[model samples]
Target: MQPILANELCKDLGSFSDNPQITGVITDSREAAPGTLFVCIKGERVDGHDFALAALQKGAAGILCQHDVEGVPQEKRILVKDPLDAMIQMGANYREHFSPLLLGVTGSVGKTTTKEFCYAVCSAFGSTLKTEGNQNNEIGVPKTLFRLDSTIRYGVVEMGMQALGEIEKLTLAVRPAGGIITWVGQSHLESLGTRENILKAKMEICDGMPDGAPLVINADNDLLSVAKVPQRLRRVTFAVHTDADVRAVGIQGDEKGTHFTICDKEFGSFPAFIPAMGEHNVADALSAYALATRLGLDPERAAQALANYSTTGHRQNVVQHCGVTVIEDCYNASPDSMKAALRTLADYPVCGRRIAVLGDMFELGEISQQAHESVGVMAAQAGVDWLLTVGEAAQDISRRASQLGVNAVHCSDKAEVLARLLSQVKAGDALLVKASHGMALETILEGFYKQFQNTTGVQDKIAGECKSWKNSRF
Candidate 1:
């Protein structure tokens, strides 16, 4: 963020006594330095206020705190009713220092992929900053803003929320030029209760847009297709199954990627292919295209940019290891993404068997059992040759698949899951590894390769890590 006088940024919070030169904002004291504003956020495990004195000791210009810290000088502390909100406000203020066509993306699934695609298309025009990985929450939103400067021409952020009003807060801070609500699902039903609530929360991305700004959405979604959007905003729609402002026709997918004809009512249609698997990905690519074109980029250039799209980290990223085709989508999961991965693997042309290694899908609340069972039904329907599941919640998947005549194996922990997979996996098989982030099922995928190298020590270390994860987080 550009440097500014502290008094200018915090005039409404309280007195600007002994105002400091604010160079940037930080939440971690370890990264604090001169002219840095350390925000004291009260978390469930660690309290940021506890690090206030440590931040000042490190030459932090000032600390934004909810209350007084014991050894910190009163003048060095910028008190507030809530430091997190104050930091968010600071981020919104900091955004005024730069001019960029900022865009926001949010949904129960696919927001991260959409964010990456948005960045790719936007960067074709100029330097663009995007949310790093899946950091789409409060802290991540403001931190992404702090990366802004005069050099960035476009900004794309994925806004995630657990309940109502969260995305509104983030969207307000982003003050998006335009935004996309990917598609609502059951990922955070634990907090928001119903899909109706989820759709409402996802639409909050519109709250930050200018009156005439475009708001893109998935017209294929039954809820969003007919749902009311703010009257002042221009609505843009993308889809594969339904009529939309922007749509894909004759969609086809191979193990390598997908091909589709881009049909648009506004910018004109063109042939497009995204080098990624699944119809969901095609939808993600189209959404990115619609959002970019709505922002006035050349339609064909935006369509061409989809060709450069690739999976990041555990998000549908394919790995060829030990002569096995591995789909390592361990980043996070909802019922929608889980089925998407399974269908991709099912459609995958394997020399021998198709195996799916699944872990628990988190945050489903009352629907957790039904969600896991539905994934199990999807696995059986997809003709998975073998099923290996980790964690107690995923056992539901095993039971449902086994009842449907699929060979399903449920393990108490990742260690057992790895052992079963190692015993059954052969050179000709394709493996799909998926789970929520906390379950850390990627370790099982990593451990499978280690066994091929005959590294028992590393294998044991992986097992121990899984045990620790099970004992702690799971």
Candidate 2:
């Protein structure tokens, strides 16, 4: 956030203003330092316009509001048709000043992981600032861009959308020089209706790419396999299935971690390892490898960076509790992600019962039942000993698992799931708690830890371990 005057911001946004030396742009009144320009955004839970006076009272340079505030001095405000659009425009304007090489990433799944991978690889070359946490949407994207400083040599922005043209708006704001689409899948298919529509929505990130910028894509995805790129852009492809521009040979993963080799005749085969579970992460690694190589990093150096990088919170992080292992992958879920998590579960060495606590996979739309059933079948095929599913939509999973001859129970809520598992789940059991972010399955993980604490009378020891686990980024 290098400070820029309002006049300079207006030049970037292509807007006309009589007073152009506005100091800074802020979204929250709480974050409005003195001499800041506050942009009032209308959000789902709160409206920023309501806090205009509060921002002004805190020494805001000016207000970018949708409408006039009742008590605030009218002369201090810049009225706009839409404050969100104004924020985007201002972000674009602000971003253009620094001109860092922007790398845009999007896909139905693995966007965050790929963002982390890209950050890891790019950091080897120079200072890089990537999208923080899961900040990949319109609001999050702008906030991420605002964090950019003068020392950053590259900016990796993850773009995510559930509807058409959303990525286009973000692409316009980012004006990325390079872009990567990880893969197209059933994620957000409910909103976009079909895979074709999903592909179309995902490709919107390329709308603002420069004419000669490179557009990287996964060569394995059926939708992206035969897709054509714009004539002005160069295409680089990567795959784990077939020979491509960047390919991962001998890909392998276990409960401990995943190991693979990046095959490149020019740089020779380099072994890469990530202390994370799942083959999907291998795909994410490949995308990052391709992007980093394109940005002029040594293949071996980039691979080493990825190998040293660890998983972030709630995404396949393994926690050992009193002889039991819990794979806490409850961050978010989709049909594709569920299958990937199930595969990781299958990879774990099990001496006792293999258990799974799954919740609803939201946003499946018309295909919700079929998706759930497929996941149930997958659970059975993965040899899960006891399957506990919560939520109405996941009942299909239980039914399908039953048809496949797996011991499955459909719980009405988390309470019932915990009650059913309390007696059955014993020491040495491997449990996986997974669901979409809205399901809050992490609460169930907390409940399990509490039970372990109470039964062992090792509450202090367990509390210390849980605290360390909670603070652990991976």
lDDT of each: 0.85, 0.81
Best by the TM-score measure: 1
Top-lDDT candidate index: 1
Q: In angstroms, how far off is 460's CA in candidate 2?
A: 16
| Per-prediction TM-score | 0.93, 0.91
Candidate 2 residues lying further than 4 Å off, grouped into runs, are 10-24, 453-474
Instruction: Give lDDT tens digits, candidate 2, residues 94-192.
Output: 887787888999998888888888888888788899888898876788777877888999889999997998899999999988899998988886788
True-vs-predicted CA distance for residue 417, candidate 2, Å = 2.6
C-alpha RMSD by candidate, in order: 6.7, 4.6
lDDT of 1 by residue, 156-232 (tens): 98899877998899999899999998888898899989999999899888889999999999998888888798999
Clashing pairs for model 1 are none
